[model samples]
Target: MILENNDFKLDVTSEIGRLRVLLIHSPDSGLGKVVPSKAQDWLFEDIVHLDTMRTGEYDYYVKLLMYFLDPDKIKGKLADIDNPESKRAFFKPDNETFHNSGKVVEIQTLLSDILQQKDIRKKLVAAVCAIEGCTYRLQLQLIDIEPVELAKIFISGSLNDEQMIFAPIPNMIFSRDIGIAINNHMLLNKPAKKARARETLLVKYIFFNHPLFEGYRDNILEIPDTVQHFLRPGEEQEGKTTLEGGDVMMVSPQHLLIGCSERTSVSGANEAIKLLFANNVVEKVTVVKIPHKRDYMHIDTVFTQVKRNVWVLLRSLTIAEPAQDESEPIAWFADKKNKDRPEIVQFRRGKKPKTFGTLEALLDNISQKDLQSTEPTRFIYSGNDEFPFDAREQWTDSCNLLALKEGVVLGYDRNDKTVGAFQKSGFEIIKVQDLLQKFETGELNPQEMTDTLILMPSAELSRARGGFHCMSMPLMRDKVH
Candidate 1:
């Protein structure tokens, strides 16, 4: 059973259960602004062409999702304000000054609403005015002029003659990292990077003002307003905590796993775990410690549950043993070339002391009741134990799969070895094109499908260093039997 929220039921207890609702953001104009020199700073491996992303594989991916999900549930980040209802709700034009009631009026209306809130209005004004180029006079003048016209000045970010108040958030398409949906409650996350801070703000604005989430304010997780905005990749600075949705996984109603990786810190996980335990929402919390590298930025980058009792994993992380008894309990990397025993290194705190015990000890505390049978907990390695194939495929997120239901999964077709591994595990592999054709010809039924892998084209999407699991943020799922 899925408990209904105000509009949709925000219930997700297991990863491989049937997906009922999802939140997806297609690539926007902001993506085109990212340049090669600043790609790494923006957390992108390489700059992707806006045209390719918009019209290529990603377009089909969103279309395929729409075929099964209700159209209303597949919300777009850029709301069309041209509609009469939207215009009325978002803007009220002033005939005396600005007559163009389309983009300018809509933005002004939102700004006006912000200015009306006495509690936050002054703070916002002070914050923007405190900047070097943003003068109080300029902000005051902005109230009258249309904001959409000044959008290029903000996006270009050259503050020479203009106030560089905003920058393009190119990574907003990976909506999974903006917020996390646990059980029936939603936690709007504070991003660990400055580049993504605005994405969190957009999500907050939606949940606070959007009609879909109107009555569920209490259900949304709350954090202090004074919290730090950004933390260095692996820096353990005090007084700040950061968490991302990509590092969170709901194993069951009672057991939740949070990975302290490059993008999520232990301090952040501790704060969340305390609240979860206090509310009696999660009985046990396992904090998995992973390598702090771009390749393994999040746990889902190397591990995901693809079907009932089945997990796709990078063997290097899960099965590898530490090099010595004195080293850390978890061995993250393996030498694919040698194809020998696991290699490990001793664990050391980055810059701050850990308030909690060793990760090994924390994970050992997982209740025995949640452990699965030996036969059922089988893992399919990314490349089926092959050499260079395993190393190359793992780098491209071969393990990151999104499950629509038990025994039905979605993956990238470029990873042939990984796809073969799934086929060897009794899953019938079918390309997205073939699957759609079957649906159109009345030969395939998604509801009755079992042990199937629906492969999606990934030539361009893989460049973003994410897969289906990273792109979607599921709000509701039918409970598994």
Candidate 2:
């Protein structure tokens, strides 16, 4: 996994062989904490029933991954392990404070009670991540702290409550958003906010220590320091760096598309690109600036690549407007007297401007652009279009599809408008329910459905702000033609 500058070529010409060996964390009791009161702040738009959501998600993983590789071939962190010795060895608390201060005992007891596990190590790990106790602890910690107070201190939320409560990570099941594996190395994402910090920790532990990934090298990246250095004076408020994997689309080994959105900033993207390029981890990183609206949280929410030279994207956001170059210059005084040490870095400032066009026009432009040049260009749409607003709305997620192989993909069954567009584009749609039935009956073989599109019912998934591709991360893909 040693990345030489020449080895990092990013080209998204096809979905083929672009990404292989994805890592995912299934939703556990951690999802139970998403309520109306806590949902929005945690980036969830709706509260979902844990049971139903899990059931739907299981179908998604089974059908989708099975289509590309053997169910046994794909790896999961939550999969069962038979060795108790191994579990204890991996999860045992290593922190001196946690072990010596009785916090380990407290955690073990709480986890055992909630997870019904007899093992102390397993219980403590799961308990710290469980929804019931985790939230109770966090809430109790924040009870009297003003938003202002909480803002000033990092990790300010409490851990002192006796009663354990956990927060729901409804988004965890969609493992692709948390981390990505490029070639032989794994990059665990550092999300923008604290609510998802646990995701980063979970990914770090799994990639570094998971038995399944023991032979692989880990290449994790964090932007806090770079953000601080690049934005200096604005680091505390405006230039806080945050980038999620969802906004990144690998066009090829040599090219990548990065979405500059609410969760990821222009400065953050610039900083990340500089690191990737300077380190030779990527040949070219194209920053596709997206909106900051809550509904459109990450770029993947609006755009996703489905096959070579073809893409399924939200017509509006993806092609709506050209991301304005809003970068602002920041001054840094490096050793005040050492005239050679003065440094200045520019940070993008202001919200992105709005687009004025129809969805089709935007897609048309993207298709026409010469994306290979070092200089960046964008495609946008004009407002007037024939489709209804609902059709356009569905296009946002309506067409956001995830591919297991070339033409084979997974999407929401309820997005008829978007589904219609796919069919029109020559995709074979297999209803998610049908696929699940076939799987249960042993009639469907994932490896056999190599180049087909499998659509999952979005009745539950759509409410949570993701689609088929959003829910699953592709670990490996056959080489593109």
Candidate 3:
């Protein structure tokens, strides 16, 4: 599936660049096993029907991505893959019927590729077995399993459909959290929750051992813990250095954004700044200290770029309604209270740190200064800036849109008000199925698609609380000059 090439590019300078390649993991068997009691612990808002997520919702996403990034794989096989009797073999990494696309890559395929080596296979098996607390006999049995099956077992935590050996990593579907690709480099994550510990371990092995990433091995950046980490917070302690990929964003070749949120701590942001500076990864790093709340787990959940001059974001970060009425004596001071406002500061090597008053201001500066957009920047607010709907749709990942090119993005169909905002912005809105049909019928082409928002089915996928942006890790893109 890797289809290794010496020319495989790894540069990603802007989030809205034309996507060439990416890493994604489809919903595995583990996603269906999430029970209600452990849903919150496992970082899910609700238990979803995994079958629907795979067939009805996510399969369309895979098809749409293939049509855009790797069309040869899905252009002619729509009917075959859409058949229920196919049992999603095209999405499964091990099956002969798998798409095995080099562009729309499956992380499991990379894991299996590295696992085929006897020594690497043994080490990975032992590591996974130890983490899952497998019996000595079972560990030995696991080591003897074939590479493809073993990789599936490692990810799904199941030996067979009937036998679950350990907890399934339902979160692996959100591959964006595993690592991120900056310009010619990969920044691996140190996740905050124990539930994601194994996910981090597995991805680290793939990124380190997979031959496709061999050349960039030296470019991989791992944030180091504080020297006094021994005295730092334990698993239950507060404010330890943990950084998830969701919190980190490479906005431009010389500009990166790191969020200090519920999953990413201030210490994590500090280490990232120092590391990127020492490594010359960027000229400026903006630290956005958002509220440490589950409501806004990462900055990406609240905002993502739709184009060089356009951003889709929650309005709460930019708009403030005074808690006290104008008639009240302390109403003016209420604005100064800074309720829910993100603390944004930019760091450059030799320059004094710069602070931004609002999220909108920082993004406008990025559009004008970093991306060189001459037009006035625009923002499409979640839920059309409506009060309760804004919060509700933000919770459903309305702001987490993934740009295929500059103006085309993928979003959930359920975010009605947000879709309305885009429609009002003179952007064309179409369901993903219809667009895919057009692509297949030659009525539309991905290259010609502009200012369009492709709506994805979200009945089951939305329950996972991540959008396509959170589900992708872009590996290559044409830089927006």
In angstroms, the error of model 3 at 47 is 0.8
In what order do the candidates fall by TM-score, top score first? 3, 1, 2
TM-score of each: 0.73, 0.64, 0.96
| Global fold similarity of model 2 (TM-score) | 0.64
Clashes of each: 0, 39, 0
Worst 10 residues of 3 by lDDT: 329-338
lDDT of 2: 0.48
Better of 1 and 2 by TM-score: 1
**Model 3 C-alpha lDDT per residue in residues 9-41, reported as the tens digit of each score:** 789998999999999999988898888888888
lDDT per residue for candidate 1 within 190-258, as digits (tens), equals 677877765565466555654445566777885442345453444535435788888888867777778
Model 1 lDDT-worst window of ten: 98-107
lDDT per prediction? 0.63, 0.48, 0.89
As a TM-score, model 3 comes out at 0.96
Question: Best by TM-score, which number?
Answer: 3
lDDT of 1 at 476: 77
Root-mean-square deviation of each candidate, in angstroms?
Answer: 9.1, 13.9, 2.3
* Local lDDT at 306 for model 3: 96
| Best-to-worst ranking by lDDT | 3, 1, 2
| Model 3 spans with C-alpha error above 4 angstroms | 5-7, 320-338
